[model samples]
Target chain A: MDFAPTPEQQALREKVVRFARDHLGARAAEHDRDATFDESGWKACADFGVLGWPIKKEYGGGGLDPLTAIMAYEALGEGCVDNGLVFAINNHLFACAVYIADHGTEEQRRRWLPALCDGSLVGAHALSEPETGSDMLSLTTTAVRDGDGYVLNGTKKFISNGPRADLFVVFARTGGDDVAPQRALSAFVVPADTPGLTARDIPKAGLRGTLMGEITFDGCVLGEDQRLGAEGAGYQLFTSTMEWERGFMFASQVGVMSRLTDRCAAYAARRRQFGRPIGSFQSVSHRIADMRVRLELARLMLYKVGWLRSRGRLAMQEASMLKLYVSEGLKTTALDAMQIHGARGYTEELGIEREVRDVLAGTIYGGTSDIQRSIIAGLMGLPTAA
Target chain B: MTDDIAKTVRSFIGEHVQDGEPGDDHDIFATGSVSSLFAVQLVMWVERTFGIAVHPTDLDIENFRTVNHVVRFVESRRAAAAPA
Candidate 1:
C-alpha cells in the first residue's frame, strides 16, 4: 500500500533529473530541425551512467532495481526536452542491452555489456520488417543453420538507433514449416560490422534524433554462440521480454505527460486573454486539469508494472494496459498543451509542436494502441483473433 | 497430487482447444489446437494456478508441450519451492 519512494530512490531520481537538465538536450531545437542525433547528449548520458541504470553491476551497469530504474527514467523524461534522444536511450537499454542481460549466457554478458554501458558501443533491436508490423509471427526473416554457425538473411525497418548502433538483436525464423508457429523463430545478437550486413537511415517526421534505419542482413554468418536463449525459443523470449519493451520504455512517456501538464499550467497562469490570465477561463483551465489527471493515472499504472516486475512476477497484461493508457494519454496531453498555448504551441518557438510529433509515435511503436487493446482482451480470457 | 495437477491443466487446455479434451501426452502445440497467444497465457496460468514463479530460463516450449509436461513442470516447481 505504500506509494512513496525510498530515500535512496528519491536521491537517484533527483540526481538523474539534475544530470539530464544540465547536460542533455541543450541543442534540442537544432537537432530536431536538422533531423540529427544528439551526439553530445548521448555521450553525456553515458558518462552519467544513464545507459546502464537497470543492468547488473557485475556487467558494468548501475544495477538499480526495476522500480527504482523506472523512477529515475521518469525523472529523465520530465527534465530532458529532447524526446528523441530519450527514445534512443530507451531502445538501446530496454530493447537491445536488456535482451542480452536477461537471456544471454554469462560469456555473452561479460563480452557485450561493458562496451554498451561505457558508450563505446550502441545497441538496437531489429524486429519489425517492411512487411511485418504487428504480425511478428509472419515475419519473413530466415536464419539457416550452417556447420557451427548460421547464415542470416532479412530486412528490418524502422529500427531506432540503427544507423549508429554497433550491435543489433535480430529475430529470424530458424524452424521450418513443420515447426509450431510459436517456436518458429530465434533471436541472435549480430554485430553491425558483420560482412553482408548493412544499414541505411530512414528519416521520419518525429524522434528524428534517434536515426531510424532499415538494416538488411544478406547471408551474414553467425556462430551458434550468438543465439539468445535456445533454438526455437525466440518467440517465447520475445513474448516474455515484451514487458520491458511495452512497459518500462513508456516510463519516459509518463514523464513527458507530467512535463506537458506542468508546461501548460504555467503558460495558462501567465498568458493573458480578454483582460485576464488564460487560467481564469474554464475551457483553458479544464484542459490543464485533464492533462494533470492523465499524468497521475499513467504514473500509477507505470509504477504498478514496475512493482510487479521488480518482484520477478508476470506483468504481460498490466504492461499492455500501461502501454495503451500512457501512449494515448501522452498524445492527448501534448495536443491539449498545443491548444492551450495557441500560437506558441503550434510553432517551433516553444518546442510544443515537436512534443506533439514525438508523442504521436508512442501509440505506434512497441505495439500499437490497437494491438495493446487486443492483448489486454486476450489476457482477460476473451476470444481474440491473435 | 500429480493427477490433480494434470486434471486442472487438461481442463484449462480443453477450454482453449477446439478438438475435445486431449490425452495426457498429446502435443497441443504440434496439433495446432491453440493460438500462439495461448503459449503466453498458458505460462501465466501455470504460475498463477500453481503459485510458482516461471523464470526466464524456464521458457522452453518442451516444458509445456502437453498436459504431462505441464504437470511435471508444476510438480518440479513445487518440489523446488518446498522446504529444502
Candidate 2:
C-alpha cells in the first residue's frame, strides 16, 4: 500500500509540468470562446511525445506503464489550464488509440499506430448515436456484410474530435434480430476519407477545444481486415476499453481538482473580505478544506485503479468508483471556487466560471454519475442496472 | 460440479437480478432483465464462485445467455484448468 511516487514518476511529472506550462493552452480563453480546437497546442503535445506515452516503443510510442502515464497526465492537467485541450488528448489516446493498441490485431496496430503516435492522424470513438448514450446495445448503427467487407450506415452524435479525426473506432450492429443485441455488436476502424462518411461540427459550451461533432456513415465500406477482434466481440472490447476509459482517463481531472483547490484557497487567503482575508470566514475556509479532502481521496482512488491495472487485476468496481468520485469531486470543487472567488470567479476573466462549465461534463461523459452508481451497486451484488 | 455451479449462479440471480426465477433457464438477455451492467456482475460472480477467470474471449453472450450456458462455460474452464 505504498503511496510514494517513484523517482522516475516524479521526474516525468516535472517534465510534463514544464512542457505543458511552456507550450500548451496559451490562448485558452480565445480558443474556448471560439469553440476552436487548438491545433498548435496539439502539435506541441505530439512533439513532446504526449500521444505516445502509453503505447509501445515498437509502435513509435514512449511505452510508459499505466501508472507512469497517469502521473504524466496529472502533471499536464495541473500545468495546462486548458481543460478542453486535455480532454481532447484524453479522447484521442484512451478512447480511440488504446482501442486499436489493446484489441487490434498486429496488422491493425502496425497500420495505424505510427501515424497515431506521430499526430499525422487524429482518432475518435464513434459509439453514441442520436438514440443511444449508455445503452450501447440499443444503438441503431448497422454494418451489413457485403462481399469481403461491411457497409456501415449510422449517425454518431456528440463525438469528441469527430470533425478533425482521420480515423474512427466505430461500433455497429452486425447480427440480425434473432441474436441477442449485446452479441450482435461489432467494432471497426474507419478512415475519414472513406467515400460515404461525413463529420459535421456540433458547437458546444465546454470542452470546445476538443471539437465535438456528429459523424454520419452512409454506406461507408470497410474491409474485413478492419474489424477489431472477432465477430460479436464488440461488447467485450467496449467493456474492457471502458475499464481504461473509466479508470485512467480521469486521472488528469484529479490533477485539475488539485489545481482548482489551490487556486480557490489562495484566492480565499489573499482576497480581502469584511475585515481581513476571506479564509478567516468559516464558510469559505470549510469549503476549501472540503476540496482538499476530495482531492486527497480522489487521488488515492485514481492511483488504486492504476495500481490494479499495473498488477493485471480486475478493477471494474474501483474504476467506476474513481470515475464517479473524481468527476463529482471536480464539479464540487469547481463550483466552490466559483463561489469563493465571487464575481471574479463568475466572470470569464478569471477562468473560474470556465472551470465550472468544464467540470460539468465530467459527470456526463465516459459514464454518467447515475450509471456509475448503478455499476457500483451491481458489483456489490445489488439488483441495480444502468 | 455442474449442480454446484448452477446452485451458485441461481443463488446470485435470485438475490441480485430483477425478475429472475429459480430452476429456469429463461433467456435473460431477451427479457431485458439482464442488462450490460448486470452482465458484468454476472461475469464477476462466475469468476469468483467458480474460481476461474473469464477472459475477454469468453465474454460472448452465448456463454452467459442462461444459467445452463454459464454452468457449461465454468465446467469447461475448470476442466481446462485441471491437471492432466
User: In DockQ, how does model 2 score against the reference complex?
Assistant: 0.38
Q: For each candidate in turn, give its C-alpha RMSD to the true structure in angstroms.
A: 1.4, 2.7
Q: Estimate each model's TM-score.
A: 0.97, 0.92
Could you say which candidate leads in DockQ? 1
Error of 2 at A14 (Å): 1.9
Chain A TM-score from candidate 2: 0.98
Residue-level lDDT tens digits of model 2 in A1-386: 78899998999999998899899888999889999888999999999999989999999899988888888888899889999999988999999999999899999999999999888899999999998998888899999999999999999999999998999999999988887666789999999999999999998868877898999999998899999988887887898779888988898899899889999888888998688998999999999999999999998898888777776667788899999999988988998899998888899989988888888899999989998998898787775544
Summarize candidate 1's per-residue lDDT along A51-100 as a digit string, tens digits.
99999999999998899999989999998999999999999999999999
- True-vs-predicted CA distance for residue A70, candidate 1, Å: 0.7
User: What is the lDDT for A82 in model 2?
Assistant: 93
Q: Residue A320 in model 1: shift from native, Å?
A: 0.7
- Cα-based lDDT at residue A304, candidate 1: 95
CAPRI tier of model 2: acceptable
Give candidate 2's fnat, 2 decimals: 0.34
Per-candidate fnat, comma-separated:
0.41, 0.34
